[model samples]
Target: MRNPKKRGAAGNSNRAHGSSAPGVASENTDGGYNAGMAVFSYIIGGIIVWSLIGWGLDFLWGTRWIVLAGALLGAVGGFYLSHMHGLTSSRKNTGDRPAAGGPSQDGGTNAK
Candidate 1:
């Protein structure tokens, strides 16, 4: 007759033989920041920059249009900048997976 503990150990070894070591899994090395957030940050930064420029011009020139113009330009620029930033960073981080357009894995784009 064989010992039960010996049999259990043998069984355990067999289970682990053909498998990957525990906790060894494919991991993304990009710190997990997705494309949307990247774009959002870029847009926000652009807006701030443009807004400041506009505000400075308004202050110096005594014109509110300048500031308004700056805000408008900033909004447009922000959208584009953010979108591009998001796409580029996403691509770099996610490898070959598509980062924009045609239905994302996480649903649709949040662009406004």
Candidate 2:
């Protein structure tokens, strides 16, 4: 009969804690403050840059609506980009899979 594979110290600790390895920190470990800051920066930065461009265009074309449109577009784009990147990073750190989006066994998307 073949001997059963043995679980090492780290392996046993991980299994015991429902697959979360000891000393592992989640993506949102610090009350999501970092992510919040990142998203905020994205939105604010986008607004500032696009609004400046719009202001310059308005100065040249004498149109008042361009700034509004640019700001709105920038906000939407920033929110979208931030949300996408956040999801991707969270999935990566939490071992989410590509198929069903659940946790993966290898701490990331399944290789096969």
Candidate 3:
């Protein structure tokens, strides 16, 4: 004789696939976190490396302002590197090309 007091399914409902804890996201990142982390690491790493180089130069050349210059240069170079890697939003949303030739950023189409 089967029990009639059960209200729902017998298995655990809170458990998720590929994970044991609850409230975990199942969507695939597709390397989204990798790109973001790369951007962050590039900026911070550039600054640290340039500052060290500048410190060495200052020690050799006997100047106190080279470190500041190196930090500034690092910031600029980091931004440039990020742009070169195409990690910025300028190249995003490339898969949604409208079939009707939608308007561009300038509020107009490129078609003649």
Candidate 4:
């Protein structure tokens, strides 16, 4: 009788497998996680930078409400940037199969 193979350490990596291991599962090089983190960083960075700018402006102008406006602007801009750069492409590549607006796929859009 032959024994079945078992999965260990969750998955494999380029360093472990030595070179690009296509079709293999791995966590060290997860594109989704990386994209998510990048989007999150954009949001947080926007907030921090804009808030600081607002603070400086407020200090120069002796106003108190500009900081709030700056924060809100930052959040909106961040969302826009993330959606424009990181998410749209990911949306198209949602699964292992080809995306929409393309031929040679098994099916079309799913009902929501």
Instruction: State which candidate, 1 or 3, has the greater lDDT.
Output: 3
Candidate 1, lDDT over the whole model: 0.64
Number of the top TM-score candidate:
3
Considering only N, C-alpha and C atoms within 3 Å, which residue pairs clash in candidate 1?
none
Best by lDDT: 4
Compose the digit string of candidate 1's lDDT tens values, residues 1-112: 7777675755565344444554322243343444456566666777788889989988998888876777678778877876654454433434766556766575556655
Q: Lowest-lDDT window of 10 residues in candidate 1? A: 23-32
Q: For residues 1-112, what per-residue lDDT tens digits would candidate 3 score against the true structure?
A: 5566764465545555565455333544344665677678788888888999999999999999999889888877887798788765544454677344745676556656
- Please provide, for model 2 over 12-109, each residue's C-alpha lDDT reduced to its tens digit, 9 standing for 90 to 100: 55443432554433543543665677678888888888898899999999999888888988888789889887622553433564555757677766
TM-score of each: 0.45, 0.52, 0.55, 0.55
**Which 10-residue window of candidate 4 scores lowest in summed lDDT?**
10-19
Regions of model 4 farther than 4 Å from truth: 1-30, 88-90, 93-112
Candidate order by decreasing TM-score:
3, 4, 2, 1
lDDT of 2: 0.70
Local distance difference test values of all predictions, in order? 0.64, 0.70, 0.72, 0.73
Q: Name the better of 2 and 4 by TM-score.
A: 4
What clash pairs does model 4 have? Answer: none
State the RMSD for candidate 1. 17.1
